[model samples]
Target: MMEIQGIDLSIIWSIIIAFGIMMYVILDGFDLGLGILFPFISDAQERDVMMNTVAPVWDGNETWIVFGAAAMYGAFPLAYSLIFEALYLPLIFVLAGLILRGVAFEFRFKATAEKRHIWDKAFIGGSVLATFFQGVALGTYVSGIPVVDRQFAGGAFDWLAPFPLFCGIGLLLTYALLGSTWLLIKTEGMLESRMRHYSRPLAYLLAWVIVITCGWTAYLQQDIAQRWLHGSHWMLTCAVVVLAVIALYGLQRSLRLRHSHKPFVATLGLVFLGYAGLVISIWPNIVPPSVDLWQAASPTTSQLFALIGTLFILPVILMYTLWGYHVFRGKVQVGDAYH
Candidate 1:
């Protein structure tokens, strides 16, 4: 690998970390959003159709999260140690919920008439639980992951604080908004119309949550707040502004058009922008004030080693993702089966 001021590995590795997390957010995020939209759906047929909307891609979507975590562990051992130690219980719950949702999703179709509701409940419950915990985790990121003496020095339940709780709710609303948009694009008839009707309101709600969370985050970390509110972090602030505009405009356009992919993509752009804001807000600090990307990054040799595999696999993942979506393009008929 090329070396520049001996910082060659750091630059490449930072890109890798950023890319991995972005991939996770963009990929797993929607499926989690799909789960969040679960309760909004009425009628068993509509729920099944909603579930089917994501069935083909949901599992594939979640893979990026695993890829992200694995990349963190491999590239930034220190960050992995700190985050894993601090977020262990919540992570466990998150994994369990995801597992339950994945299994129950498949099993619900095969379940006997008597046990079908059981599976349905499992699916919904699992989705809610998983999404909530993941949101809580996001809040923890904003609140700061606990660290002491270069190691995680906080309780497992530290993630369950009040601010994190609010963040969890915010994430729930955001995911629901995404699911609603996806429904507008993927399904048709009354269900799609209902989903479209729900989109703007849900997006508005999510925007409220975002404002509240930003305020709370600023309150908790005055310095970070100043950085965000002031013109210090101009680029990231610009991203947030752009995201807000896109989200609002896209929602309006989608509402007018009734069903189009642009709004969904715009919603995804909002997600990207939101995540970028968070990352920028916590610059030079991975766990905040305790560790940074450079501090947490592995040695040059290991990073280089991993880059080889990443270079090969990343394209393949992208190709398959695009191909899958391409093949599944157009509205899905409710009578059609997910499997």
Candidate 2:
């Protein structure tokens, strides 16, 4: 265990927690987004291809969520309590959707064509519900978590506000971009070509929505703009912009060259850069201006206890994820082949 200005070893654990959450969002988020875009494929064969694109990896991908939640519960008990209490309904909905989707995922394989159609719809619905609510939860945090004496003072619908709603839409488009990129990488021929064509237009639209949403957010909370533009945090905004430009250009070139790998890799980089910008821009504030990291964290002893297990488990998870992807890294097939 190391110390930073005599801060507890738990701070490292907090970093791990943050890392897990962001990683989960970027990894599992694309698959969920792909699942969300399932309905748009129109053709059942293409839909099956999309489904197979993520089937092998989706369940494993969700492990990060567990890691993140456990880390938060152990290292930041206050934050865990506050978020769960405040966002109980949304969390419940997210969990329900995830469970339904997971079940529907397997059921779709066993069910007949008609029953499979129902399960497919269920999976898509579940994915959308979970994805949208996750966005709403983030939006609530951005807008600020209502607090009174370290407890939630807001209603259940507090997260469904206008700014949060826009953020939700932003998240939707963001995921759609992710889905398109995944399709570009995982499929070939006509489907891959279609995904490639769809990606740029979707990315452009998502970029527009994101810019407008950020502007709207700044308008709503003047401090966000003030901090983003004139404060010490301006560098993050520049970084995000530069990365976005690079990602866009790379995506354009990838489409032209029909590169299977470039677009997904570039999009992943863009997502990480954007997520990192958000994290840095809002550091030391777990629940924004009201709650600082240290104040939200668990006791040092409790954190040390959690660290023991995380240290053992984290590397295993990392190794397995890398190995799984390495094993499955190739063109996904449609029709009666196993994924």
Candidate 3:
């Protein structure tokens, strides 16, 4: 395997894939959260404003997931195949939800008043379904898949467990909180105030869920628990917890101060911290319990080739994404339309 400064190409690819997934989560998460928040918003104009806030950048945000998946396929074909095999059902449902949501997002604007409510329902249902199943997939992955000889050996319904279900609910709340903080940044007047009101409770619920999920995850997987609680790993765990507390405190302070951007920034910090913790817990394991990065990685030649393309393309994606957000930077009004 090729090495750069003694670091394996597989490890580098792992980092790239992880970064892509993180970008997807933080970027698309808020838009998905907007859909989840749709039910709470009764006023048609308010919903319009909420949708418009994300309309300019939402579709572009999904590019990261595609990037991540493609990177995995090119750089870690073994792990990619195994993971997809294990997660086939949930992944299919995730695609379905995304399709539904995308269709609703476009049609909702074009629909008449009578038909708009149907699209509204589609948006909400799609968002909830996608978020929930994504969580289930995460939980299932964390719990470990049964892989035998590089093939998935698990049952199709293995994901339908208590832990995964709780995770599904937890993720729903997490996205709702993200959406609320995002609204705080992109809105004003009564909508902003309502989002502010919603943000606190959502944050509180998310905090509880995070704590419980951590404990549950630890209890359910001894290897992970040892990784988190034993040896020098405990310090990293402490740092993550400290950072989480700080983020939570900052969020509350920002909300109290009525600072629009700070709340969203703090929320992003919390999400990053959680994502960092997950990576730390499962470091080097592209597929836990068996497959390490090296085991799952494609040939060094393939990884190097893909890495070159990724290096060239990733910056372009980032540049344009930033440009889009910059162009649309402002409070979205009711009449605003990105479609």
Candidate 4:
């Protein structure tokens, strides 16, 4: 394996993939949340304003998913192939939803006033479709995929289960919370107040979902249960639970205090803690219950080559993403046109 000093290149690549996925979830997640929130805001003008808040940077947010997928394909082909094969159905739906959502996002602006509702429905449907399946995919992954002889050995409908379906609901609430907090940052007047009102319930619901999901996950996966319930890892589990509670409390308090930015920041903290906890649970396993990073990794030379290019490209992506957000900073009013 390629090494920089003593660190395995596969490990380095895993971190890179993890970072990309986290960034995608936090960034693209809120935009998807906006689509999920469309049904709640009956006023067409308010919906437009909500969409505008994310218009400037939403497409850029999706780049991380592409980057992560490419990194996984190049750095860990075995795991990539197995995962994709196992998740082909949900992933296909995710892609279809994303395509529909993207099309609706652009076309909604050009659409006639009477016909705009069509696009709105499309947008909402696409967003919910994408987010739900993504959650299902995550839950299915966590529960584990059947693999044998270095290939996927699971049935076509293996992912259809109550736990995965429940996880779909959990992610919808999670993203809705993110969306409301984002609006708290990017809107004002009645809209801001409405978002604040919506955020409180979303936060509470999300907290419950997180707790239930964690418990369900532990019940289904004994290895994960042991990791969190026994040994030194138990301390990490406690820390994660405590930090999640603190973040949830901060989010609720920030909303109550009408601190616009604090609510979003706190939501981000909660999202990060959740992501971190997942990582802690499945450390060293790109494919859970079976494949470790090294076993699933590509050859050393392939990893080294990809790492070199990724190091150069990642910074550019970050720079441009930051610049785009900087230029678009501040409230998106009803009259504003970001598209």
Tell me the tens digit of each residue's lDDT in model 2 across 254-316: 877888888878777777776776665467678765787788877677777778888899999
Instruction: Name the regions of candidate 3 deviating beyond 4 angstroms.
Output: 1-5
Q: What TM-score would every model get versus the actual structure?
A: 0.93, 0.93, 0.98, 0.98
Q: Write the per-residue lDDT of candidate 3 for residues 1-339, one digit (tens) a residue.
A: 557678689878888899999999999899999999999999999999999999889899999999999999999898999888888898898899999999999999999999999999999999999999999999888888888988888898998899988988988998899999999989989999999999998888899999999999888988888898778889999999999999999999999999999999999999999998898778768887778888888877788889899989999999999999999998887677755
Sequence-dependent TM-score of model 3: 0.98
Off by over 4 Å in 2: 1-10
TM-score of 4: 0.98
Candidate 1, 1-339: lDDT as tens digits = 334467677667667778877876666666777767766675778878887877788888876777778888887888888887877877788899899999998998888777878877887788778878888887887787767778777777889789988877887787777788887888889988888788878777877787787778888988677777676687668768777777778777868776578778878877877887887788767777568777888877788788789899888988998888888878888777866
lDDT of 4 by residue, 24-98 (tens): 999999999999999999998899899999898989999999999999999999999999998899999999999
- The residue pairs in collision within model 4 are none
**In model 4, how many backbone clashes occur?**
0
Off by over 4 Å in 4: 1-5
Candidate 2, residue 199: lDDT: 82
164 Cα displacement, candidate 1 (Å): 0.5
Global CA lDDT computed for model 4: 0.92
Full-model lDDT for every candidate: 0.78, 0.80, 0.91, 0.92
lDDT at 164, model 2:
72
For residue 284, model 2's alpha carbon misses the true position, in angstroms, by 1.0
Between 2 and 3, whose lDDT is larger? 3
